[model samples]
Target: MEDAAMEDGETNKDSEVAPALIAVHPTQNSVAVAVGSDLRVFDLLGGCAVSLVNDSDGSLHKDSIRAIRYGANGKLSVSAGDDKLVKIWSTKSWRCISSVEVIESLLTLLAVKR
Candidate 1:
């Protein structure tokens, strides 16, 4: 049955890809978008793309980013997704300051902090 499903190009729920997500800065100066494993930002003031700096050795998110949020004060941003990693960013510098792996058991705690 599994082989037949594969041959028919049927995809399981777990294998389904997520839709792109968009987040606007609190001050409405910029907007960030997550498409697949790529992250893009646009400057509302300049009417151009904002180049982001990732100090890490690899891409921001290894998998699709499911959520992107900005702090109420417009000073910080967060991104998390299927890669099982959460990242904190500095909105001023547009740089990633920290990243942590997500543990299934601690998911509740993380959500509560958000």
Candidate 2:
């Protein structure tokens, strides 16, 4: 099957190519991209890359990330993947706050203001 990265305009020309899973911050001009096993954040306007969270210390996901989104407050971000788990992360500390499992593949995540 074709990878989602290819659909996102990324090409795999190398042996070590990794799929890209990206999420844009709600209020900031920044974006988060999960390439291979690493999560990278970049500035949209400055064109400079920013590093938000690195799960290199341990495995971030059992498989590739399928979706990511900014929370309602813009202080948190959410990620869901083939692992069948949804992770909540803090924007300030870049730390995982919670993880919840769900049935079937997680297709999307939407943040609602309360």
Candidate 3:
């Protein structure tokens, strides 16, 4: 989940800010989570919350990640953030496959494969 400060008139309110928590897809073998400024993908079936992927290279997003969802093929996962960008990663290799800018602060992203 992503955390953002609410703009209150002229000042930004930080005290009332709340971080977002993203849930993984129920049928996916992996789970994606955004904690603080890092994006982590976990191996759900392994019992231990093992880290399978990480996006902390400063190129992904400066702020927290807002949303994460598995693609229709179950082999890809998409993530969007306040950075106004959407990134798609492969579940098998846990590598970035594509990225697109939507020009708006993306609240969520869903990838469908035909």
For lDDT, the strongest prediction is: 1
Better of 1 and 2 by TM-score: 1
lDDT tens digits, residue span 58-95, model 2: 55667557777787667988777767777777888777
Best-to-worst ranking by TM-score = 1, 3, 2
TM-score per model over all chains: 0.80, 0.61, 0.66
Question: In model 1, where do residues sit more than 4 Å from their true spots?
Answer: 6-15, 105-114
Give candidate 3's error at residue 107 in angstroms.
3.1
lDDT of each: 0.77, 0.69, 0.65
Best candidate, TM-score: 1
**RMSD over all Cα atoms, model 1:** 3.5
| Candidate 1 lDDT over residue span 24-104, tens digit each | 887868999988778888898999987778787568888778778888887888888777888888888889998888864
Q: Which scores better on TM-score, 1 or 3? A: 1
Per-candidate alpha-carbon RMSD to the true structure? 3.5, 7.9, 6.5
Can you write out model 3's per-residue Cα lDDT over 31-101, one digit (the tens) per residue? 67776446777676785554344454436556567777776667777777776678787777777777777
